[model samples]
Target: MIDSRHRRARLGLVSVTALWGVTFSLNQVALHSMGAATLTFLRFLVASLFLLLGFGLRRSFWQGVNRAELLGGLLTGSLLFGGYLTQTEGQRFLSASLAGFLTGLSVVLVPLILLVLHRGLTRRQFGATLIAAVGLYLLARPQGHEGLLGIALLLACALFFALQLVAVEYYRITTAAVIRFTLFQMATVTALAALVAMAPGGGGLLPLHASQEAWATVAINGVGASALGFMAQTWSLRWLNSIEISVIYSLEPVFAALVALIALHQREGLAVWIGGIIVVVAMVLVSITPPGGATYPQESST
Candidate 1:
């Protein structure tokens, strides 16, 4: 049997996934008042700072910081920042719950990316994909705030996020270095957001610099979502296969629903409850231990 430490790691991954789910409501709270770009910039800037602190906590975390890793970090950071920005922007028009649910569809997309990369998927993968898809339909309540456009944008966010995950797995960085790598990426993402903020759009929400609320959002999103979340993901993922981790993360929506109900005073109908169950069930069916490709986790698109 797996040791207690390994068991703890697996439990930690579930907890991390739960924390990640809790963050959905927090992000919605932040983005409600801030521009997507400005909020995205702040999140990364804060997450970058956290990353630096994290690096300082341990030696040799950056031992593998070579040119390839640097470039890869930059690329990953850019994609991640852009994907998050898009998701945040989408959230402006969408409900936090739906955004969380739909974006969590990355597990479906992860497997597809694996397939493209020559890693074949199993029957379980296909089954989970279908269940998650059905969950998507249920979560996509018609009366909600998010429309077709927002849905499409969130889906795109999911795609790019999946790419980043596959890339992270492919990069061959040690698990111990994941947070440092995340820091490097956050720095790159912050720089990119700064540059983008400069482009003729009137600062997006940069004018809210003095707004305590905006700054608070930045902290919660950056530290809570990016830095801390990344750490939790790594901590939990160490004990489980990527596939298992992905499946566990597929519960983000359910977690988000609970978070929303408690924190955001958000309500979900029977449809959402039923749909979420379908999605979770599908993930369980498809996420067995046989080891397959073509399925992945969608942490927030996240």
Candidate 2:
């Protein structure tokens, strides 16, 4: 039963990554209309509202709220917000290839952070991390000398993302409370994005002139990526560990490239294909290798 639950969680998390990949491609169309923060505000605003309407109707959902869920949601949301903020600002000074590679560095950060916290690590985990790191570099094919500021910002983005994964596992948020927990996260990002949108030189909450396509992209990402994607991620955490989750997330770029290739008719070089394959191998390694020690007990369904 444990193995079965883990397999299901892995599949669900992979689906979330694929959803993110689709949205990542769509963001190019939306960015032409508004700043990242402005787009973020609208996306999460839609997400929070959608969650409220979908689950708020249940009185039991309200009763599930507790201090742990609130605090867990706040920490995870803030870390998530930090990741977005850094990645968005970092792109200004770095190439997309470099930024993506750095963002995916969370896969490496997760293991390192776990080690620092006295968590167990197996040879398989180390090998997979090394392989995935190589795959990311080849895939990104970063050119030119990157600036210190951009590198720092994206690395910080990786750290925030890594910490958020750790926080999710540590919290052990229950399945029954996942909806409430995710709602808090959505609301927190929504509120923070609103603040960023209103800050000096923020370009305001709404764009001066947004295309219909842009608005439509926001709506799709809000429902599919932000709302459903996050809820699925939180629930999956009951079975998957922080390290496993981060490694699975490395598939995001591969999925993004595939989506672009299929939908946008974008072409990739041989190196891109090779790198993507290597990343997949890494994911398979994680799935098959037995963990070395107990981290957290898997939470059973309610």
Candidate 3:
């Protein structure tokens, strides 16, 4: 079971989760300050630089890369971007906490995707999913159904995130040695987002020069959150079960909610507090329980 490797991977997973948990608020700040497309571009562009320069220095950095591998990278990157695009668009209306919880719904959506694929899920995964669903409800109760648009976008993001997970799980490409391929995927996303950002009537293309805070946010996201966070996430996925990934990811909202309350001074209603507790409990169980009773690579290189 590669026990030593698995332990390191899990540690990486936790690190990734910690950073991502707070990113929901960070993302919201970025969306408000810059065009979504531009913000997205900068995140990946900076990440690409890190990956390229860091790995490029090593001999045979592209040793395992090929057109097919690049394509797989592109697919994974696209799915990731789709999740972000839906998420950013949804944020125009949704609270960051609500959106973060809804996005974590990918945990439930993934097993469902497996069911449709005829691969199906073990009873354990299904059971864990049901509990998570109840947690999701607590976190997502709407106000008289008036928040439908945001809900729909959140749901869409969840579904895409699930697809991304599945793609990464089955992807036969060298999960490591991904620097070149990751760059390809990042470039595609950046190009597409830039075009969309520039389109007339789109979120006005250029970045906001007036807000240096926004630039700082963008730099932080690119370096700390997106690039570094995702490298950990992808690496952890190599050793961890999807359930573990989901459990850790569930923390993103819990952490985001806390950050909002402590740092942003946001108030929470009773329902939010109750729901938050439920989600935290569920995440704790899911993390400790494991799927099929198992435990993720997870080096900085990923």
Candidate 4:
């Protein structure tokens, strides 16, 4: 029974990773009809609503919110906003494959950040970081000055995401609090994105004037990638170890690259492919080896 459950959990997590991976390409295509801020707002708004209706219908869920959870939600949400905004905006100038590889850098960044915070880093993690840096250089080297701004933004996105993971770890959310905590974070992102959309020249709150493709992307990202993905990961944790989960999650970039090339017809040169592979290797290394060889929870990528 346990083995069967574990197999199911692995499959579920892989499915969740694929959902996340596909979004890189989907959002890139969808950006043709909507502004990044508007897209971000709509995406999270949909996600927040879905989660609310699905899990927040209970009065107990609302009443369970302590001050700490509220604050944690705000902090994590701000970081998430930074991540998605930059990621979506950055995708305008980058191929989905490149964006995936760059975003996956957060895997390496998290351990390094934790190490800086005195969380202790193992030799394996240190080595992986060095390797990832080299991989990044290889990946970005061929692009030269091309998409430099997008590269910078995506790098920032990775940093913000890494910080968000650290913050989530610090908050130590419990099993019961997962739904409530995630809802708060999603709501916060939605509110912030709405504020951005309301600003002058920020585009209107709704993308009602946008194309059907744009609207569909928002729906898929919000309901599938954000809401359902979170639930899937949380569920999988019941059977998967952190290392197993992290390693599986690291395949997100690979899936993104494949989806872009095959499904979206995006093309990349040989150097980019090799560099992307190297980056994935670095991420896998970081995942299989925890910080200081101690147990650490590695969250999914954006």
Candidate 5:
């Protein structure tokens, strides 16, 4: 039986996934008024400020940072920034559905990366991942051809996201304080994105003339998705393996479709309904599988 703790972790991850799903539509509105770089910078800036306020300015918070946390945050944060940047750039060239499908490829890439790290998933887990991938393809129904550069960028984004997932699992094991580690990671992403926004040839550093709606969307994404979502993910990594996490996150697009249907009155095709069912089935299979004798490692505390 799954323990209460594991169940709670699963619930937390589900909530995070839902928050992320909501961002799909919210970001569409926000991006209309600001460059991707500006949006990213503001999102992370809000998240970092919120974290700082909650954690406060303590000597240990700033001075006790170990090498592992610093290095891990830099690596993870960079990969995250790359993932978002490339995905945004790719979307400019590819259809929205196709770009989303390509981004979801990270679900497949995560297990592959873990295998290379000598942490292969169980056969059952692998099967579920394949099933989930198929569901994602159907749900996305990706069509049309894009420039090779855009395709390549989306593929790179998937790879970066996969690596970020593995890095989070590894770092949660090594870092002393998950909160501090998350804070540093958020700060790094904010700084990198801000630099890109302010670069010589880039659009201006700030969205000084952004609309109120854009600001509200940014605020929601920052506090809900970036701050709460990321921290919940980092904390949950201690209880769940990377493959499990990836499989669970595959439901994000499913949730997004639901949000669109209910909130925006957007209609989904038959393929989407079938795909949603398949993905949920995959999630059930993974969730019910016994944890014993699995090759994947689970670290309980940092």
Candidate 6:
């Protein structure tokens, strides 16, 4: 039964990654009419509302929320907001395929971050990181000034995402109430994004100039990618460690590439394809490798 539960969690995480992958193309479309800040604000606003409505239906949800959880949510949500903001901004200057590849650097970053936090890395993990680093260099081969800038921004996004993943694991260990924790994090992200949108010289809070297509894209991403995706991820982490989650999430770029090909008729160069394959292989290694002596917290269903 325990193994079956873990398998179910893995499947849920796969679904979340696919949803996130499609959002790359959807976000690119929405960004055509809306600024990054405005789009992020509206996206998380819708997501937070959906989460609130769903969780509010249960009395236990409210009782589960407290000051400690809210504080934890603020930290994790800030990291998450940084990641999304940088990724969205970077996507403006990169192809959806390239953006997806660059963002997947978080998979490489995760092990390094864990190492710094005193988690022992196996020889295999070190080799996988080296392989992934080479893949990133090839995948992000400079196309010029704009492309370099996009890659740099996406690297920052990867760093922020790595931090957010580690933070989520820490919070999960302490709190164990996945639904309440995710709800608060979503609310925090919504508030932060709204503030950015309303800031001086930033876009307005509402995407007033956006078209019907843009709105539809945002709505789909907000509900499917942000709200449901995040909740699913939080729940999955109950059964999976941070490294396992990162490895699973590495598949996101493959799904993004597929969506770009089907919807946008996009194609990358030969070098990019080879580099992407290398990165995927590295993630596969990480996934197949058994865990070391690191002390992962006990799995929780709540």
- Which number leads on TM-score? 6
Tens-digit lDDT track of model 1 for 196-270: 766777265365444666677677778877877766654444444455566777888778888888888888778
Give the higher-lDDT candidate: 3 or 5: 5
Question: In terms of TM-score, how similar is model 1 to the real structure?
Answer: 0.83
| TM-scores, each model vs. reference | 0.83, 0.82, 0.83, 0.88, 0.82, 0.93
Q: Can you rank all candidates by lDDT, best first? A: 6, 4, 2, 5, 1, 3
Better of 3 and 4 by TM-score: 4
Tally clashes: model 4: 1
Candidate 1: regions farther than 4 A off? 53-64, 141-146, 173-176, 202-205, 209-211, 234-238, 291-302
After superposition on all C-alphas, the RMSD of every candidate to the true structure, in Å, is 4.8, 3.5, 3.5, 3.8, 3.6, 2.1
In candidate 3, position 223 carries an lDDT of 75
What would you estimate as the lDDT of candidate 2? 0.74
Q: For model 3, what is the error of residue 19's alpha carbon versus the real structure, in angstroms, after optimal superposition?
A: 1.1
**Per-model CA lDDT versus the true structure:** 0.69, 0.74, 0.67, 0.79, 0.74, 0.83
Candidate 1 vs 4: which has more TM-score: 4
What is the lDDT for 158 in model 2? 83
Residue 72 in model 2: shift from native, Å? 1.3
Candidate of highest lDDT: 6
Clashing pairs in 3: 239-296, 240-296
* lDDT, candidate 5, 1-302, per-residue tens: 45777788899999988877676666666667788888878888899898998884766667667798888988998998898778766655654434444565677777667566776577876787789778766754533355456667877987998899889888887664677877777888899998999997555567778888789978998899888888988888767777778777777766666665666565656775676577666655654436484434566444
The true-versus-predicted C-alpha distance at residue 31 of model 6, in Å, is: 0.7
How many residue pairs clash in all the candidates, one count each? 3, 0, 2, 1, 0, 0
Task: For model 5, state the Cα shift of residue 220 in Å.
Answer: 1.4
Give the distance in Å from residue 226's predicted Cα in candidate 2 to where it truly belongs: 1.0
Task: Please say which candidate is ahead in TM-score: 3 or 5.
Answer: 3
